[model samples]
Target chain A: MSRVDVGALVDEARAGRPLAVARLISLVEDESPHLRAVAEALSPHVGRARVLGLTGPPGVGKSTSTSMLVSAFRARDLRVGVLAVDPSSPFSGGALLGDRIRLHDHTTDPAVFIRSMATRGQLGGLATATPQALRVLDAAGFDVVLVETVGVGQSEVDIVSLADTTVVLLAPGMGDGIQAAKAGILEVADVFVVNKADRDGADTTVRDLRHMISLGRRELGPSWRQPIVRTVATSGSGAEDLVTALADHHAWLVSTGALGRRRAARARAEIEAVALRELRARWGGVRASERLDRLAERVAAGALDPYAAADELVG
Target chain B: MSRVDVGALVDEARAGRPLAVARLISLVEDESPHLRAVAEALSPHVGRARVLGLTGPPGVGKSTSTSMLVSAFRARDLRVGVLAVDPSSPFSGGALLGDRIRLHDHTTDPAVFIRSMATRGQLGGLATATPQALRVLDAAGFDVVLVETVGVGQSEVDIVSLADTTVVLLAPGMGDGIQAAKAGILEVADVFVVNKADRDGADTTVRDLRHMISLGRRELGPSWRQPIVRTVATSGSGAEDLVTALADHHAWLVSTGALGRRRAARARAEIEAVALRELRARWGGVRASERLDRLAERVAAGALDPYAAADELVG
Candidate 1:
C-alpha cells in the first residue's frame, strides 16, 4: 500500500511478470486499502494496450470467437491479455476458464494471459473494478487487451462501456438477433460478427443483422457502419476477417477522435464511481445517526412518504 | 417548495386526487430543486398499498396480464394504481402509455389510475425516482399498486427491488426464459407466469421453468417454492391463479418476517443513492480543483494510473 511496496510492484508488473500482474488485479478487485498507492504506481504505465470488448448472448460462440481472435492476434506477434468478466457466462463457464484449458491453442504460449473475474458481492461492483483491471493489463505491456463479457442486463452495458471498440457476436437460430435489438446492443456495437456461419440459419441471421444495422444507420445517420464478419469460430474460420473488422473499427475510432473522447468519458465515470463509493459509506453512517429508523417506521405506516423521509435524512 | 405548498399537495394526494399524485411523481422523476420540501410534506401517509412489480421481456403480454389483474382486483372492490415505468416497452411504449389507450378496459374506471414513466436520462436515475413515485401512489390511497417494468438488464432489477411481491411474465417462446435466468430474474421472482399458454411450446416452457426452479431450489435451498402459473392473459384465463400466487407469496413474506427485512434493505439502498448523488455533484467540483485533467493526461500517456489520480482528488 505504501509508496515502497507499490514502486517495486509496478516495476515487476511492467516487466511482464505474471505474478505481479495477477497480484495487482487482485488488489483492485478487492479494493485493497492501499489501492490509491497502487494506482499511483500504475498511472505512469497504462494506455499502451488496445482495449477490445467482445459481447453477445449465451450460446453465441463468443468465447470461441475470442479464442480465435487471440490466435489471430498472436499470429501477428502481438502480446494479448484476455479478461473474462462474466464468469457465469456459458461461453466462459466453470470448465472453460481454469487455466483456459478450453483454449488449448494458446495455453502453452507465454505471450497470452487470461483471467476470469468472479462476481463482486454487490451489483455493479465488477463494473467499477473492470477499468482498473484493464489498466493492470495495459501497464503489463500487453499489446492488445480483450474483455469478453456476457451481453445481457446492465452488467453487459457497463462491461463494454470502457472498451475502445466493442464487437457484438451472434450465432444463428439461437433467437439472439431479436434479443440483441431488444437489449439495445445494436446501438453500442462497433463491429458485428455472425459466428457459426455454417449453420442453417446463419445467412438469415446475417441478413437480419444487416437490416437492423441499416435501419440503425438511417435513424442515427451513417457514420462508421458496422461491418458484418461471418465466422465459424470453433473451426477458426473467418478469424482473420473478424480481426480485420475489429482493427478497422479501432482505426475508425482514432480517425474520428472518438477514442480520445471515449477515454475521457470513461475516466470521468471511474472518478465519479470512486468518489461516490467513499461518500456512500459516510452517508450510510449519517442515515443511522439521523434516526432514519424512526422515519422509516412512519413512512411504512402511511403517515409519511419515503421522499420526505430521505429529505429529512439528507438535511 | 415551502412547507405550505407541500402540505397542501400531500393533503390532496392523500385524498386520492389524481392530479396531485401525478404532479408528485413528476417532481420525483425530475429531481425537482424543491424536492426536499415535497419529501418532507409527503413523508407520512404512505405504506398502505401492496406494491406488485410485473416484469418480463418484450411481447410477453405484460399489459394484458396487468389489465386482467386490475379487473380481478376491482372485482373484489380493491382500488388499483398501475405504473408502467417502461416507456420503450412494447406494452407501455409511447402509444400504449400516452393515455394508456391499450387499457381501454379501465381508462374510464374511477377505481384505477395508470401512468407510464419515461427514462430519466442518467443511468439509475429512473431507479432512484421509482420508489418515490410508488410512495405517491401509495399515499394517494390506492389499495393495490401494480408496477409494470420491462424485464431486461439492470433497470428491471432496480424496478423490481421495491416490490412486495414480484411476478415474472414469460410467453411460450420469445426466447426469454433462459434470457431471464441469465439476467438473474429467477432469483427475484416470487411467482412465474407463462402467459400465452394457448400457444405451442407453452407446456415445454412451463416444464423448463419448473425444472429450473427445482434446480434453483436445490442450489439455493428451498424457501418459498415459486409457483409456475399458466395463463392466456388476453383471454383472462388463469388471472385468478396468478393473483392467488402473488397473495400467497405476500402472506408468506409476512409470516416469515421477510417483508420487513426486504423493505428495510430497499430503504437503505434508496438513502445511499440519494446521498451519493449529492456527494457526486460536490466531487465533480473537486475533480477540477485537484487537476484531474493533468492526471488524466498522464494516465493516457502511460505516466499515471486512474486509481492514483482518484486518490489525490479524494484527499
Candidate 2:
C-alpha cells in the first residue's frame, strides 16, 4: 500500500477504529514503506497509556502473576491491555503454544485485551514488531498496557528500559541468588517480587536479595530502596498486596516527580533504538559496511588490530 | 594515548600479550574513546576463532556443562575464550552473577580466557558490546570461543546467528515441557542436549524431544537429525558424546557447504545489528526524538495520528 493509505489508517484508528489501529501497528512494527504515514496517523492517541513491563527468569510464574494483576486493575475499572511475549522454539522454526493461555480467564472479558507474540527470530530479546504492537495497544484506549517479556536475561533487562514501571520476579533456591546480585535485574527493578514463596528457601532468597541491595549502595547514595514482596501465586496469596505495592510504586513515582523522568527516558530509548535501526538499514543499502567487514576480516586473521580497523571505518 | 600508541596495544595483543588483549577488550566493552582505534588495530586477528554458543533455560547446568566442555577442549590442546553475558539489574544498575565463577578451575590456565559482560542496558538478546569483545577475542588468537547467553527464552536463539555452532540444553521434567518447545529453541539447535540426565523422567523428556522433532521433519529436511544426547554435567557423564556430536555437526556443516552459508549469514546479521545501534545513537544525540515526543503527546490527546506524525519526522 502507498504511504497515503497508511496515514489514513492511523487517522482512522485514532478515531476509535480498531482495524485502523491494528493496521497502523503492523506498519510501524514491520517498518514497511507506509510506516511513517501510519505512525503519523496514530500518534495522536498514544501518550496517555502507562506502560509496565513484567520480566524475570522463566517459570517464575509471570503469566499467572500478570493475570492476577490484570484482574486487580480491572476491578478498579481500568481498561487493561496485556501483551505476552511467547518465545519461538528454535527447533520448530514456528510458533507453538504461542498464545499466553494463562490469561484465559480474561478471554471473555471485553475490557481486557491479551495478545501473545512470538519472537519470530527477531534476535534481540523482543520481536521486531513489539514496539509497534505496544503502540497499537496504546492507541486502543487502554489505560494501562502491560508488556510481558520472554524472560531472556539481557533482553529482559532491556524491557525495563521500555516501561515506566518494571517488576522483576525471582524464585527461591534458584542458585541465581548470587547472580542476581551481579546487578542486571537489580539495576532495572523498580519493584521485585519473590514468586512461589511457598517453595523452600524463600526466606533465604529474600535475605540474600536484601543483602545484594546493600552492595549497590557502595556506588550510589543509600541505594534506592526497592520494595520486595512475596507471593504464592498458585493460591493467589498476596496478590492483593502485590497490587497495592504496584499502586504504591506508581504513587511514589508521581510524588517524587520521577514518573515524568522515567517516561522521558523510555521515549528517548525508544526513539534512539528506532533511529539506530533506520540508520543501519540505510547504511547497508549504501554499502558502507563493506569496508567495515574487510576490517573485521583483517582483525579476525590477526594481521591488524581492531582499534585501527574501527578508526579506518569511521574515517 | 594517541592513535599510534593504541595501535601498539593491538600489536602487542596479537603478539600474545594478555594485558594488551584484556585492555583492548575493556575498551571495546566500555565503548571507551579508544574503542575505534583498538578495533581497527586488532582487525586482522578477529575472524580466525571459531565461536560457539551454549544456551538453554537457567538451572540446566549450562555453566557446569560449559566447564566440562572447556576441560574437553583443553585436553585437545585448544585455546579457548569464554564470554558470558548477564542482564543488568534494574534496582542496582550492575550485572549480576553472569560471570563464570564455576569455571574457576581453569582460571590459572594460560590457555583459557574467560570474561563476563553485562547487557549494559542494550536491548535485544546480546550485550551491546559483545560483538566487539568477540572481535577482540578473535583477534587475540583464541582458537575457540564459547559464548554462554543468559537464558531468557526465545531471545536466546540470537546466539545461534552469531556462533558457528549452537548447543541448546534442556533438563528433564521441567513441567513446562510444552512451554519450552513453544519458545522456538528447537529450531536453532545444532545439537539438542538433555542435560542432567540423571534426573528422573529424563527418558520421557528425550522421547518427547524426539517426538517434537518428528513433527517438523518436513521443513528441516530428512538429513536434519538433531541428536538428543543425555548428560549429567556434574559428573561429566555423556560430555564426551556431546563433544563428539558437536564435531559431527561441524563436519556436517562443512560437508554440506552450510558452514560457508552460516558465516555469510552471521556477517550480514552482525553488520545490520551494529549499524542499527550506531544509527540509533546518532539520531538520539540530535534530539530528533524530542519532536517525536511532542507529536506523541498530540496523538495521545487525539489531536493527530501517528502516521502523520511519522511522516513529519521523516520528511
Candidate 3:
C-alpha cells in the first residue's frame, strides 16, 4: 500500500487516462492494501458522475438495454462508464461476457469504458468494491457511470442504493411481473422498463406493473411516481423515452433533497461494512478461533445458545 | 433485560407446556430485552430437535408440503412445531395466514404447534429471531421443528443456512424449474420436491432440474447428491418417498460427520450475526451520526471518497 505512487495515478486519471482508472478500479476489486491511499488521492476529483442502475432477471435484455442507453447518453456528448456485476459462469468463468460483447461497439471511442466484474465471492464484498469502482470512474471524468446488476436477490437492493435512478427491467410472457411484486421490486424500482415491448403480452406486462405500482403508491403515499417505459432495446426504439424518464427522476431526486439523503445513507452503510470487515480482520486469531470452536461445540451440544456464545466471545 | 423471570419460563418449557414455548417465541419475535437471559435459561435443554427448512416460490405448496411433513413426522409420536416466515402484506401486516388455516387440521392434536412470523422491520432481525424461536421449540421437546419460508430472495438464503436439511420445492408448469435454476436453488437444496406431481409437464420440470443439477455438479464437484423427489402434497401421493429421502439425507449427514460441520457453521454464522448486532448497538450514538454526517458531506461534495470517509470514521 505504501509503495504505490498514488499521485501519478490521480494525475493520469484526471488527465482522462482510462488505464489509470482501470488500475484504480482493479486495486479496489483486489482490495489492494493501498486502497485508502488511492482513495485519499482521488477523493477530491470524484462525485461528478451521475449514477444510473439497471437491473432485472436474466434474459430480460439487460445488456441490450444498457448498450442502447450508452448510445443515447453518448449522443448527448456525455462520457460514460459501465460496470456490469455478474456471477462468473461456473462452466467458463466470466465466460458470460454478453455485456462485454455488446459493449465492444464502443471500444474505439475514448469517451466510453465498460468493465465486467464478478460477484467476487459473496454479497458483502460486492457492496464494498462497487462504490470504489464508481468513484474511480467518476474521478476519471466520466459524466455518467451506469451500474447494471442481474437483479435477482438482495444484492439488487444494494445496487439500487448506489444509483440516483434505478430502472428495474422486465419482459413479456415470463410471469416476471408477478415475480417482481413478490420479490418487492415494487419498492426498489424508480423507473420500470418493459423491455422487448414488441413481444406479445408486452402491454399486459406494462399494465400489470402500472397496476401494482398504483396499488403500492396508495399504501406508501406521496412519492415520486414510478413511470413505466416501453422499449425494444435491441432495436433501440423507446431508448429516448427511458433516458428522459431517468433524467426526470434525477431532477426530482435533486430538487426533493432525497439525493443528499440517499447519499448520506449510502455513506453510512459503507462505513458499517468497512468497520465490520476491519473488526473481523482484527478479531481473527487463534484465540478467537479456539473460543469460537468451544462455543460452537457447546451450542451444537445444546449447552449454550449463539447469542450467549457471541456475548462471551465479544466480551 | 434482567427484569424478566426467565427461570419460570424455562421451568414451564421443560414441563412440556405449549404456552411457555409460545411465550418464548414471542419474546424472540418482539426481540424482548430479555432475549439473552431466555437463551441462557433454555440452552441446556436444546439440541434435541431436528430442524427442517421447507422453502420455495409462492404457490409451490410449501405450506402443504410442510403440513404433510408434520403429519408424517407425528405418526411416529414425535411432537412437531412450525414457524412460517412470510412477507408482511403492506396493507394488513403479516396477513399471509395461509399456513394457519392449513394447519387447522392439527390444532386439536396436542402434539402439533404452528406459528406465523413476519419479516418485521429489518432483514437482520429475522435472522436473529428465527434461530431463537427454533431453539425454544427444540427445548420444548418437539422432535421436529419445520421452518417454512417463501424462497424469493436474500432472506430465503438466510433461512437455508440455518437448516440441517433444506427442501426446496417447485411445481411443473409455472416455469419454476427455470426460476429455481436462476435463483441458485440448485446449490442450497438438499432435496428437491416437484410438488403437484399429478400436473402436466411434471416430467419436463424434473428432467430440466436434473439436467441443470448435473451440469452444475460437473463444474463444482463432490458433496451431497441432492435427491429429487416428486410429490403430490395435496393427496400425499409421494409424501412417504419424500420423507424417506429426507431421512436418508439426514442419515448420510450424520454418518459423514456433515451434521456436526453444518451445525458448527450455523453456530459460527449465528455468533457473527449477534456480534454485529451488538457492535451496532454499541456504536449507536450522536457522536457516530455526527461523524457520519461530516464525512458524508465531504464525500457528497466530491472532496472525499466513501472508502476514505469510512476509513477516517472507523479509524
Best by lDDT: 3
Winner by DockQ? 3
Which parts of model 3 are misplaced by more than 4 Å?
Answer: A1-23, A55-68, A84-123, A149-155, A169-183, A194-223, A232-237, B1-23, B55-68, B74-77, B84-123, B148-155, B169-185, B194-224, B232-235, B305-308
Q: lDDT per residue, candidate 2, B1-315, as tens digits?
A: 434477788778767677777788888776677766676666545567878887776566777777788888998998888887633221112323443344557867878877776554555325346777788788788888888864445444565467888887889977454455546667777788898899898999899888988887778898758899999887889989988998898888889988766665565455455544553454446476577677555544556544454445545
Chain B TM-scores per candidate, in order, are: 0.90, 0.88, 0.90
TM-score-best of 1 and 2: 2
- The per-model lDDT (C-alpha) reads 0.74, 0.67, 0.76
Clashing pairs in 3: none
> Which tens-of-lDDT digit does each residue in A52-80 have in candidate 2?
88877656767777777888888899888
Chain A TM-scores, one per candidate? Answer: 0.91, 0.82, 0.92
Evaluated at residue A209, the lDDT of candidate 3 is 85
**What is candidate 1's lDDT per residue for B190-218, written digit by digit as tens?**
89999999999998889888888888887
Candidates, ranked, lDDT: 3, 1, 2
Error of 2 at A59 (Å): 1.6
User: Model 3 over residues A238-270: C-alpha lDDT tens digits?
Assistant: 999998999999999989998888777766666
Candidate 3 on B64-97: residue-level lDDT in tens?
A: 7887888888878889988877442211123346
For residues A1-315, write the lDDT of model 1, one tens digit per residue: 443476788788778788888888888888787677777777767767899998887557777788889889999999999888754443334343532465876756777888877643454466667788888888889999999876755555776888899998888886634554445677888888888899999889889888988777877667788899999987899988888888888888889898887887677667656655554455548556457667656555546555555666667
**Docking model 1 quality class:** acceptable
CA displacement after TM-score superposition, residue B145 of candidate 3 (Å): 2.9
